[model samples]
Target: LHLPAPTDPLLRALHDILRTDPADNRSLDDHGRRIGASARTLSRRLRDDLGLTYPQWRTQIRLHHALILLADGTPVTTVAHHCGWSSASTFIDVFRRTFGHTPGTRPTT
Candidate 1:
């Protein structure tokens, strides 16, 4: 999750938009339109600049925010909702797959 800052202007703008709302589930085309680029251009730039496709980057962003909220004692269901997961169970599955443990098992500081 430690992505370096994107040097490309478009990527930086896209990152700002994505960070503004992890729950923003707009299609790539829609996002592209918002930023005045074609989806293909955006996709290529994301891959080149960040080594992540749009979905991958978005998932990472969501998971990062989820960790912060969880550390603050947010409930699983609420965190799932805020992070744009379909449900708490889905979030738990993804979290377990990524971290090898349920969110509740995290050794919070």
Candidate 2:
């Protein structure tokens, strides 16, 4: 299944949380607590309302921010950290997979 339509309220709330802390590397339970929802409820809501699992959605959020940071001339290592990646290598791998190029290859704006 795909993500919820852009107009979905659930997507808005999730976007708010993500934008506030794009580097948030917290567990699903921690995210649930921050939003005043139980982990199970958050999981269910994401699945039912947004057609996404927590990690899947978070990865998309992180990658989007990574691109922005890279374009703005943030160091690739710093972008990795800012995007909540455990390591720069992992970040490079995911960035390459998602964007078809390594983060280092992106021309800075």
> Which candidate leads in TM-score?
1
Please name the candidate that would achieve the greatest lDDT relative to the true structure: 1
Clash list (residue pairs), candidate 1:
none
Give each model a TM-score: 0.91, 0.80
Residue range 60-107, candidate 2, lDDT tens digits: 888877777887999999999888988999999998887777888743
Give the clashing residue pairs of candidate 2, or none.
Answer: none
Candidate 1 lDDT by residue in tens digits, 16-84: 887889889998899889989999999999889889889988888899999999989999999999999
lDDT of 2 at 38: 77
**Candidate 1 overall lDDT versus native:** 0.87
